[model samples]
Target: MTYPPDPYQPPDPYRPSDPYRPLDPYQAVQPPPPDPTPSYPPPYTPTSPAPSSGSGYPPPPPYGGGPAYGPPPGYPPPAKSPFGPPGYGASYGPQNTSAMAIASLVCSIAGVVTCISAPVGVVLGHLAKRQIRETGEGGEGLATAGLWVGYILTVIGVVTALFYAAIFIWAIAEGTNVTTTF
Candidate 1:
């Protein structure tokens, strides 16, 4: 007989005793130290803002509708022909050959572009080349280039004029007032 049986007792429910807890995994994962120098910009978002200049140039203009602008302020515009101007060549600095070439190639345009302001692209081109060769000036290419372009343009204009004439003859026989589109 083991004395009177003692009753088994459980731990106290209200009072908590310290219990060992493993370290938190997140605590070990610290965000990398704040970057001292970021390599990339944070972000960019376009909202709404008018351009600083060209305010007059609309979003888009109808083809060949508005007047073409000349060179910027104080800058002289390209002469009528690349080879026309005595002082207009690129070897010294920036040249305007491209403009001259384009202008020379179109007879209608050449008249307005050449410094002499007439059907003189061919003549000017030759003179320009001569000047370039003898005096070491620039624009030899421009003059030679203009001569070819002017010739081509003349041929094109003739063909175009002939086509229009044929159309005019047909219209006259048909007696129809056909309106030519501008």
Candidate 2:
């Protein structure tokens, strides 16, 4: 068969390989962006005054000698405080050292003769020492000295009594007349 004298319409004249390469007529070209913003705060608000301090702290409390500055509507004032304890700081000093001293004095006679009373004197002397400690007193050495003295005296008295008793018995056993004056 014979070919047609001219082929179909020619190809596009504006292709990328053309002598003057053209941007697509349908698209737009734009420039790049600039730099950033400034540094700072926004703002502030207002306030009120104090009832007493003008800036607002509460007031100091009141004082007096009588009832209230005007008394309540009718209530009485508070009662006066009383002194505390049995003696209420009377003398404000240590107790007497005489407890042990008196016990020591009693021990002299009791220790020298009666064996039973001698132990009582020693117990009293110990109690006196405890009293001095509990009461911040002056009987420390006094009571100790008294107790030992009483104990020693008791020992001496007992030994002397036994000695005399032995001697008296020996006298009678030897057929001698034994007479004792109290």
Candidate 3:
């Protein structure tokens, strides 16, 4: 009677063992030896005609005929970063102009044209100067110009009024001095 196959034996014990495997199953297998001299393809040989002896680079195409190397037609240029460049300190947007300063300038101009708002312009100009000093806003030139214009116009208005009053008084006195024939 045939005995049962041993559990430790390989499934196909009759088949030939692998040539690369170690004789002892427990031993570490060694890799195949490498070739002493590497084999590589033969050096490249150019088939095209030889380049000109002068500069090797080909000449550029005639102006306007070559391909353009910028943004496509109708497309806008790339947007610049608001935060400046790498490693450079950050750049900020424009500072805001003071509203009071603008108002002062407008009122002063109106006063010059209408001769009624000079005092208002002067008051706004002083306020604008104070606000600009505290808040660090722009438009200082506008405030100063308004102040000068307002001051000059106000003084001129006062002097002209006084002169007209004096003339009216002199006319009344001259009329009283003349006796009426009636």
The TM-scores of all predictions, comma-separated, are 0.31, 0.37, 0.51
lDDT at position 126, candidate 2 = 80
How well does model 2 score by local distance difference test? 0.63
Candidate 1 per-residue lDDT over residues 1-182, each given as its tens digit: 12322222233433323435554545533334544654433232345344345464324423674347875434445558755657644455664344443444444346444424334665556556666666664465666667876565656666777999999999898876665788
lDDT of 2 by residue, 11-47 (tens): 3344443436676788554433332333222121234
Supply the TM-score for candidate 1. 0.31
TM-score-based ranking: 3, 2, 1
After superposing candidate 2, which stretches have Cα over 4 Å from the reference?
1-95, 98-101, 109-118, 176-182
Residues 14-97 of candidate 3 have per-residue lDDT tens digits of: 333574664676665555455455343323246544446545444343468535787554445677999777675434768789
Q: Report the number of the highest-TM-score candidate.
A: 3
Relative to the unseen true structure, what is the C-alpha lDDT of residue 182 in candidate 3, on a scale of 0 to 100?
75
Report model 3's TM-score to 2 decimal places: 0.51
State model 1's lDDT: 0.53
